[model samples]
Target chain A: MTYCVGMVLDRGIVLMSDTRTNSGVDNISVFRKMFHWAVPGERIISVMTAGNLATTQSVISRLEERSKTPEERSNSLLELPTMFQVAVETGKLLRETVQDTQSENGEQGKGRFTASMIVAGQIKGMEPRLFMIYPEGNFIEASFDTPFFQIGETKYGRPILIRGYDRNMSFEDAVKLLMVSFDSTLKANLSVGLPLDMMVIERDKYEPAHEQRIEATDEYFLSVSSGWSDALRTAFHSLPNFSFGQPGNG
Target chain B: MTYCVGMVLDRGIVLMSDTRTNSGVDNISVFRKMFHWAVPGERIISVMTAGNLATTQSVISRLEERSKTPEERSNSLLELPTMFQVAVETGKLLRETVQDTQSENGEQGKGRFTASMIVAGQIKGMEPRLFMIYPEGNFIEASFDTPFFQIGETKYGRPILIRGYDRNMSFEDAVKLLMVSFDSTLKANLSVGLPLDMMVIERDKYEPAHEQRIEATDEYFLSVSSGWSDALRTAFHSLPNFSFGQPGNG
Candidate 1:
């Protein structure tokens, strides 16, 4: 399992991904799930993947390798005219990757080799956009009513995003909200681990505004975790007492 | 779908369930998911159901009808020697109900009529106990590590319980925690709706301590919805600002 979230705010786009993969409770490993590509000052694109590591690796490898071979990379992610087109190209690539792998293995019921991605960024002059790519290689863009998209182990972390997200929010606020969302997922799921990959793209900057790998012992995250627990405990105590009704009131 | 939670605490047990059923977003209706029985001073038991409504109703109807029969009510829930036995009987009833329904339909797939339950209560001589009954007629009791069990749309509401729940928490505190959990679920899932049913069983007391139905407009719940949104916003802003490697010579 994995948890990755992206918010498209007025200030820019904020993306965060956890780095944990597990075959079972006893077999757990850390693997970075966030990937980025930027033609410095031209275009900056970021994607975070979840579901079937092998499938995601194949899709990403294809994308990266295309960057080196001009002929093989035509109509690829980097050359797309707009973010929407980029998503379309990436979705096509994902579909091709899955079909090729299954045919080579000849596995009858591999159950779709599930994989999805959160793709967000800007093209030279286009607006920053956010999209959630589905396992079927189709995608949906974030709109005014939904300015953020999440993939993988999403339910556990959805409440924070629903209540705290603001389209007009500053990039810093967006990152903070993402941390809280990721924190919830990390605590509830053992398959989602630490040392998160976080990146921020300032509007029209065409380059990453900030990027960092958050380790388990990072001071900010430690404070966020402990502080949230304390806040919740305090809030729990402050709620009004149950009336329980009078003996005759039932 | 529904959202029901049961907690076993040192003070006693807290059981809460939402009354919402939906076949899809378009076809939704209100249907209580909680049932209770009280042999006034002898025993008090509350069962909350989730999953197939037809199966749960059949299981509860059978249990209810048996309690009224003189000769056939021997291993009935009310006559059970301990709370654990009561749970086992409920699980067996649920499994039997599913089996009968499946055979009637002549289906060869996994029984779609299966249901899960959270049973919590007290018998005269024993302490309060809580059990989560699976569709397979098997059950497990709540322990210190996991003092509460939730059924139905559980994920959205899980974080509050994980962070605020304490085995020794006051009965009032536990109810509030349950409400928050329910609030989270209600906000995130349309399949789980209003008019929640809640019952409290006090330690060693064989009758329900408190029972009430919360309407959609209940003031407390309204406050919880808005107050929680405000709290999230405040928490988001309170997180430390990220300067992200500002060339500070550190």
Candidate 2:
């Protein structure tokens, strides 16, 4: 299980992903699931993955391998004409990677592996875009009605997004909302772990405006966790009771 | 899909259930999921069901039918000597109901249908108890570590329970927390709908201490929904930014 979210706001785009992967209860490991590509001022694209780790890693590595070779790197993320094209190329690679890996184990390559990705970024001339790529290599771009996309362990964190999201929200507030959303998910699920990778891209900047890896001991996250708990306690106490039975003296 | 939660606190027991049932996106209907039987001063039992409404309704009707006959009423809910016996009787009825329904459809009687229930209440002389009964008829009582049980569409509302639960919490506080949980589930899933049924049973009392069906137009719930949205937005704005960078004026 995993949790990754991408938001395309007026100010910029925000992407965050947890780093835990588990095959079973006893078989758990930490693996960074975010990959970034940049061509300085020309373009900057970040991809966050969830689902089968092996399939995601293979797809990302194939993209990287293609980028290293001058001939094959033309259609790479760094050279893509637009963010939409970048998402399309990435999804094709993801589907191909899952197929190649599953075929090696004598499996049919259909049911053995399934992975998904969130592609968000800016190009030299196009507007900042966000897309959620499916395992079948198809993708859907975010619209004003749904300015964010979340994949994996999404339910626990969705309410915060639905309630707090605004089309005109500043990038700073968006990141904080995403943190609270991620914070809620991490507290409820063991499959999502820390050293969370986050990136913010200012619209039309064509480069990452801010980026950081949030560790378990980060002071801001610590404050957010304790503050939320305290706020909930306060809110819980403030609500009026049933008041039916003479405000029970017990 | 459905969402029902049961909590056992020091003050008493709290049970809440949504009234919507959905077979698919196009096939949704309103059905009550909470059932109760009271023997006045002797015993009171409330059962909330999720999954396969037909199966659950069958089980409750069977119990209701048994209570109608003098001889059979001896083994019925109203006559259960203890809370534990009440749970066992409910579990047996649930199993039998599923078997009868599935066999008539020419499906395997054991695994063809899935149903989960949260049973909570008290016998006149006993402390309140809460039990979660599974499809296999096996049930587990809530403990200090996990003081509540939620069946159906549970993941969306689980985070609040993971951190907000407290056995020493007052009945008012407990009910508030349960409402927050239910609100979150309602926001994230369309299958869980309005007009929630809630019951409160005070310890040592066999009858319902307080009961109400929260309709969609309830003023308190409306306040909760709007206030929660504002609170989340305010909280999001108060958090620190990436900290490593200046406010990206880019």
Candidate 3:
């Protein structure tokens, strides 16, 4: 399982993904789920994937291969006119990969090879765009009312996002909010592990503003995890207590 | 759908349940999920249920009916010598109820009529106990390491319980902890709704020490919900920001 979140904030886009993939409890491995491509001031795109590892790897590799060949440059990420086009083409590749794998493995494997992705980035002239692409080649873009998308192991981290998200918040605060969300998921589920990949894309930059790998021993991540827990305890203690209506209690 | 939680602490026990039941989103209604039976100084038992509402209602009704009849009183909740016996008997009744309903409806209804329960209480001379009874007439008791059990829509709220649970905490603190857990679940899910039922049983007392129905307009609950959100935002801001490694940024 993987847990990834991408936010389309006013300042830019923040994308975070955990690097844990498991076939079973004993067969767990670390696999980077975030892929990025940049052509300096022309275009920048990042894809965060969840679901079938094989399918996502195939789709990503095909995109990379096409980007390198002059003959396929028209359909490559580097040449996509807009982020929406990149998302559409990425979804198509994902669906085709799943279909090919299913046919190779036959009928019983029909739904076994499936993957979903969050595509976010910008072209020089257009504003930053974010989209959640489904396994069936359909996709939905983020809106003002719902400026974020999460995939895989999402429920545990969702309450924090619902309560704390602000569309106009700073990029620093956006990263902080996502860290809390990911920390909540990490504590509740063993399937999602550490060594997180995070990218920040400032609006109109057409390149990554910042990117980092948050390992288990990262000081700032540890501080956020423990600080959030302590803050919750303090907040709980500050709440008004339920008064009993019994004799001498109220 | 429902959300119910029960915890065994060093001081005693705390149980809470949301009052929502739905066949579908359009068919939601408020229904109390907590039931209690007590003989004052003899014993006190509370059952918090989740899953099929019809099955749980039938099980509770049967227990109540048997407890009222003089001839069947020997096998009733009032006659059970220990909390473990009460749990075992409750599991049996739950299994019987599901089996009867399925038989009446035939093969297509095999798993449609099923419910689970958290049974917590104490008999004179025994310590307070907690058990989660499955639909199969089997149950597991909570241990010191895992002193709480939650049923239905449990994942969203589980992280708080994992981080905040303390066996030595006061009953008031325990209630506060569960309020946070339930509030988290309530926000993320539409199926778990307002007007929660809470009960506390002090060890060896054999009766409820406090009980309340928390409505939507309840001031204390409102404070906890809003305060928790504010505290999280503050905590997020207090964490160190991720510094870019470019020139003049560090």
lDDT of 2 by residue, A70-171 (tens): 665544777668777888899999888777777776746558788999998888777888999998899999998889999988988898789888878777
- Predictions: Cα RMSD each: 2.9, 3.7, 3.2
lDDT of 2 by residue, B113-218 (tens): 6798998888876788999998777799988778889999998888778767888877767767777888889988998999888889888787888788888887
* Model 3 ranges with Cα > 4 A deviation: A65-75, A99-107, A246-250, B65-75, B96-111, B246-250
TM-score of chain B of 2: 0.90
For every model shown, what is its TM-score relative to the native structure? 0.92, 0.90, 0.91
Of candidates 3 and 2, the better by lDDT: 3
Q: Where does candidate 1 stray beyond 4 Å?
A: A66-75, A99-110, A237-242, A246-250, B66-75, B103-108, B246-250
For each candidate, the DockQ is: 0.46, 0.40, 0.46
- What order do you get sorting by lDDT, best first? 3, 1, 2
For candidate 3, the docking band is acceptable
lDDT of 2 at B83: 76
lDDT of 1 by residue, B1-250 (tens): 9999998888889899999988778988888889888888889988999999888988888887754676655437777788898898899999888888788888563558878999988888777889999998999999888889999998999998999888788776777778788888888888889989988898877887888888887777776677777765665655666556633301
Per-residue error at A153 for model 2, in Å?
A: 0.7
